[model samples]
Target chain A: MTDDVAVLGAGLHPWGKWGRGFVAYGTAAARAALLDAGVGWREVGSIVGAATVRGGYPGHVAGATFAKALGWQGARAASVYAACASGAQAINTARAQILAGIADVVLVVGADSAPRGFFRPADGDRPDDPDWLRFRVLGATNPTYFGLYARRRMAVHGDTADDFARVKVKNAAVGALNPNARYRKRLTVEEVEASAVVADPLRLLDICATSDGGAAVVLSSMEFARRHGAAAPVRIRSVSTVTPRFPNTVLDLPDIATDSAVAVEPSGETFRSSIARTAYEEAGIGPDDLSLAEVYDLSTALELQWYEDLGLCAEGEAAKLLRAGATTLGGRIPVNVSGGLSSFGEAVPAQAIAQVCELTWQLRGDAGDRQVAGARVGITANQGLFGHGSAVIAVR
Target chain B: MPRVLTPVVSGWFAGDGDDFHLVGTRCSACGSVFFPREDVFCRNPGCEGGDLTETPLSGTGRIWSYTDTRYQPPSPYVTSPELPWRPYALVAVELEAERIVVLGQAVPGVTVADLAVGMEMRVVPGVLHEDAHTTWTTWHWRPTGVAG
Candidate 1:
C-alpha cells in the first residue's frame, strides 16, 4: 500500500443555486477547512485549486484566486482542470505535494457557480473541440447520455424505473440530515414517476441539477500532523487519477462516438471500474474492506452503475443488491451516505473534493445521523468529461 | 437556391442520399479508425504510429442505445427561442465492421417509442438549423427499413 497522507480537515459551503461567484464559495470553504484544521493560512506551504469554467479567465486560475482571497503569504500554488474530476485532481495534486516533501501542508479547494439548465460549450466556431462538435452537430446534452445508460440498464438488467426511484428515495432521506445538501425532502417512487421526463425514460428527479457550491480539504505529512498534536487523524491511502485504455467501447459523454475497437480488443474493465480498481490496488484493500462509499450520483440510475463498477457486487447485480438494502445506511456496504450529487446537485470542480469530505466525516464518526456505525475505510468514485477518471480511498 | 448547401462542420461527412456516409481517418499501420475524422495522428497507444488517411465509414449500423431530448438544448446547439421546441430522439449506432458507436439525432418524428436497442439504423443527411442565407446540415440516424 502507498504511504498515507494525513487528512487534517475537510469542509464545504452548502450546495444550492446561491447566485454567487465561485470565488466567494471557494474562499468560504477554504476558511472553514482551515478553522477545522486549527492551522493558519500563513502556515500552509502550498495550495492547489480545482478549476471551473464560465467565470472568464480567473476561473481557470483558481489557485491564485483563492490564495489572494485568503490573503496570500507566498504559498506555492497550482491550478488544474479535469472537468468533473477537477476536484479529485486538485486533491491528488495536494496529496502528491505532501508525499513528495515539497510541502508540509497543502490546501486543496474546488468551487463553482453553475449555469442554470443545460450546460453548453463556450461559443465560437471551434471545430477541433469535441465538446463543441457534439452540441453543434447533434444537439446532444448531458441528460441524453444519462437517459441512454438508464434505458440500457433496463434492457440489460431489468432495472425498472422503480429501482431508479429507490436510489433517489434512499439518498434524499440521507441528504435531509446533512445541512450541506440542497434538496432535503424525501421522495417517493410515485413522485419520481410523476416527475417530468427530462430525457427518455429518466424523469427530472432522476437527474442532478446545477448549483453553486464549494469544498476544500487540508492535507499534511504524517510527521506534520503528529507535530501539530493531532494524533490518529483520518488518512488518505489512495487517489486514482486514471485514463481509459485505448478502444474504449462504451460511449461516454461529450463525445459523438466511441473509439474504434478495430485495431485492438477493448479492455475488460470499463473506465469507471478501472478508476476504483486503481484505488483499491494502491490502498491494498478490496471492496469488502470498504465501510462506506460516496459516489457521483449524477442520476439515480448512474449510482447503480457505480455499484457494479466499484465491485460492490457483480455486473448486472446492482439492482439486486439495492433491492436487498445492502447499500443503504445499515447494509453490507452503505454507498453514497452523503446524499451524493442527487442531494448536492453538481458544483463541478467542488464535487470530488466534497466526496472526500463525506469520507472524512464517516470515517471519523462525525457524520451524525447519517454516519455509518464504526465506519473505517471509505471510497469515492467519480468521472470527468473527456476520459478523466477519479477515485479516492480514505481510512482511519 | 437553398442558400448554398453546407455541411455544418465541413469534411465530417459528404455526398447525398444513398451515396452519403460519415467520414473518418484510418491508421495505416495499426488499422485503427477515428470518427469525426482524426487527420493528425493515430490514437492507438501500442502502435509506433502511422499515417492517418481520410476514409468514409459505413452508413449502416445497429442501435447501441437511444434517448430523446425532452427539453431544448442550450446554445451552440442552435434551437430557436421563438419556436416551440420539439424533442428529437438521439441514437448511438454501433457499426459492426468498424466497431465504433457513433451518436446522432434520429430523423424528425422518430421518438424513443419508434426505436429499440439492437435495431438497424442508417446515417442520412438532415437539417440542423437554418437562416435567411443558409441551412446548416448534419447527419441523422433513421431505422433502416422505416420511411415516411
Candidate 2:
C-alpha cells in the first residue's frame, strides 16, 4: 500500500436548492471541516477546489475563488475538473501531496449550483466538440444513455423495472437519516413506480437530480495526525484514478460509438470493474473486507452494475443480492449508507469527498442512525464523464 | 420539391432508391474502421501508419442495443421549439466485418416498442433539421422490412 494519509476531519452543508452561489456552500463546508479538524486557516499548507462548470469563468478556477473567499491565507492552491469525479480527484491530489512530503495538512473542497432540467452543453455551433456533436446529430442526452444501459441490463440479466425501483427505495431510506441529503423522505417502491417516466424503464425518481451542495475534508500526513493528538484517525489506504482500456466496448458518455473489437480483443474486466479492482489491488484488500461501499448511483440500474463491478456479488447476481436484502442496512453489507446520489442528488465536485466523509463517520462509530456496525473497511466507486475513473479505499 | 443537398460529410452515401451506404475510413495499417470518416489520422495505436482510405460501411447490421429519447434534447440539437416534442429511437449497430459499433437515429415512424436487441437494420438518409436556405441532412437506421 502507498503511504497512508489520515482523514483529519470531514464536513458537509445540507444538500438542497437554496438558490445560492456554490461559493457560500463551499465556504460553509470548509469552515466546518476546519473546525472539525481544529486547524486554523493559516495552518493549512494548501487548498484544492473541485471546479464547477456552471459557475462561468470563475468556476473554472475554483481554487483561488474558494481560497479568496476564505480570506486569502496565501496557501498554495490548485483546481481540478473531472466531471462527476471532480471531488474525488481533488482528494486524491491532496493525498499525493501529503505522501510526497509536500504538505503536512491540506484541505479539499467541491461544490456546485446546478441548473434545472436536462443538462445541456455550453452554447455553440462547433461540430468538433463531441458533446455538442452528439446533441446536434443524434439528440442523445445523458438520461438517454442511462436508459440505454438500463435497458441493456434488462435484456442481458433479466432485471426488471422493480429491481430499479428497489434501489431507489433502499437509498432513500438511508437518505432519510442523512441530514445533509437533499431528498430525505423515505421512498417506497410505489412512489418510484408513480413517478413520471423520464426514460423508458427508468423514471424521474430513478435518476439523480441536480442540486446545490458542498462537501469538504481536511487531510494530513500520518505523523501530523499523531502530532495533532489524533493517532487513531481513519486512514486512506488507496486512491485509484484509472482510465478505460482500448477497445472499450461499453458505450460511455459523449461517445456515439464503441471502439471496434475487430482490431484488439477487449479486456476481461470492464472499465467500472477496473476502477474498483485497481483500488483493491492498491490497498491489498478484496470486496469481502468491505463493511460498506458508496457507489455512483447516477441512475438506479447503474448502482446495481456497480454491485457487480465492485465484486460485492458475482455477475448477474446483483438483483438476487438486492432481493435477498444483503445490500440493505442490517444486511450482509450496506451499500450507500450515506444516501448516495439517488437521494443526495448530485453536487458533482463534492460527491467523491462526501463518500469519504460517510466512511469516516461509519469507521469512527459516529454514523448515528445509518451506521454500519463494526465497520472496518469501506470503498467508494465512481466513474466520470469522458473516460475518467475514481475509487477510494479507507480503513480504521 | 427542391434538389437534395448533400450533408456536411460526403461519399458516405450516394444515389437514390437502393443505393445508400454510410461512408467511413478503413485503416490500411491495422485494418481498423471508423464512422463519420476519420480522415486526419488512424485511431489505432498499434498501427504501423499506412495509407488510410475511405470505405463504405456495410448497409446492414444487427442491433447491439437500442434506446429512445423520451425528452426534448437540449441544443446544439436544432428542434422546433414551436412544435410538440416527439421521441425517436437510437440504435447501436454491430457491423460484423467492420468490427465496430456505430450509433444512429432509427428511421422515422420507428419507436422503442418496435425494436429488439438483435433486429436487422439498414442505413438510410433522413432530415436532421432545415433552414430557409438549406435542409440539414443526416443518416438514420431503418429496419429492413420498412420500405422508404
In model 2, which runs have C-alpha deviations exceeding 4 angstroms? Answer: B1-16
Candidate 1: what lDDT? 0.92
**What fraction of correct interface contacts does each candidate retain?**
0.89, 0.66
lDDT of 1 by residue, B1-148 (tens): 6586778988889888899899999999999999978888788999898999998999899998899999988768887789998999999999999999999999998899999889999999998889888888889999988982
Per candidate, the number of residue pairs that clash is 0, 1
Which parts of model 1 are misplaced by more than 4 Å? none
Candidates' DockQ values? Answer: 0.87, 0.68
Taking all chains together, each candidate's TM-score versus the true structure is 0.99, 0.97
lDDT of 2 by residue, A1-396 (tens): 788899989999888999999999998999989998998889999999999999987689888888999998789999999998898899999999999999999999988998888888999677777788788889888888888889888988999999999999999999999899999998889999999888776899999998899999999999999999997999999999998987788888888887777777787789999999999999999999999999999999999999999999999999999999999999898999898999888888988889998999999999999999999999999999988899999999
lDDT of 2 at A30: 94
i-RMS for every candidate: 0.8, 1.5
The alpha-carbon lDDT assigned to residue A328 of candidate 1 equals 92
